[model samples]
Target: MGNRILIVDDAAFMRMMIKDILTKNGYEVVAEAADGQQAVELFKEHAPDLVTMDITMPEMDGITALKEIKTIKSDAKVIMCSAMGQQAMVIDAIQAGAKDFIVKPFQADRVLEAISKAIG
Candidate 1:
C-alpha cells in the first residue's frame, strides 16, 4: 500500500482537488476532515502517514490542530496549506511542527514535491 494521508480543508472543492492529486499520485487518502477539530479526530482515528492541513478553518485552525496532533504523536508529519498571502501563518505552522506547506490554486508538482519531501 502507498503512504496513507488525511486531508483537512473547509472547502469541499479544495479537499476534492487535493484528494485527486494525492490519489492520482498513488497516495492513499485514509480520511478527510472539514475543520481542524475534525482533522484532529480523524488524525487520531486514521493515524495516516501524513496530513495536509489548511491554515484557516472554523473549529480550530491548522496551527492548533498541528500542535495537538504533535502532542498525540510527536513525530506526526503534517503539511500546512495556505492561500496566496498567508506567509505568516505558514511560518507559524512550521514552528508548530508542520513539515512543510503548499499554496492554493494548488500546483500538482509542488503539492507532490511537498508531500514526498515531508513523508519520505
Candidate 2:
C-alpha cells in the first residue's frame, strides 16, 4: 500500500490503530481527522489518494463528508468504516459514491484488502 491515505474517525485510538497498520505496510498517512467537517477540510487541503472514513461522527457524518468530497473531486476514492449492523448506512454510503467499506474493529488484512481493491 504505497498510496497516500486520509484516516477519519472520531476516536483517537481508532485513528492511531489505522495509521499504524497503514504506515507499517508502507502507505503514507497523509492526514487524520476526528470528524466529517475536518475530514472534508483535510480532503481539500491534502487530496489524498484514498480516504478511510468512519460512518458516525459529530459535526457531520461520513456519508455527508463523502458527498462533499465527491463534489470537490468526482473521482475521489473513499472507503467507509462502520461497525456491524450498519447495513442501511453502508448502503447509503455506497449510493453516495464510497468506493468500498470496512466494518470496524479494523482487521488489518481486510483494511489493506479494501484499500488495495479500491485504489487499483
> After superposition on all CA atoms, what RMSD does each candidate show versus the true structure?
0.9, 1.1
lDDT of model 1, residue 84: 86
State the displacement of the C-alpha of residue 59, model 1, in Å, after optimal TM-score superposition.
0.9
lDDT, candidate 1, equals 0.94
All models: lDDT? 0.94, 0.96
Off by over 4 Å in 1: none
Q: 1-120 in candidate 1: lDDT tens per residue?
A: 438999999999999999999999899999999999999999889899999999999989999999999999999999999998999999999998999999999999999999999887
Instruction: Output the number of the lDDT-best candidate.
Output: 2
Could you tell me the lDDT of residue 103 within candidate 1?
A: 94
Q: List the residue pairs that clash in candidate 1.
A: none
lDDT of 1 at 94: 95
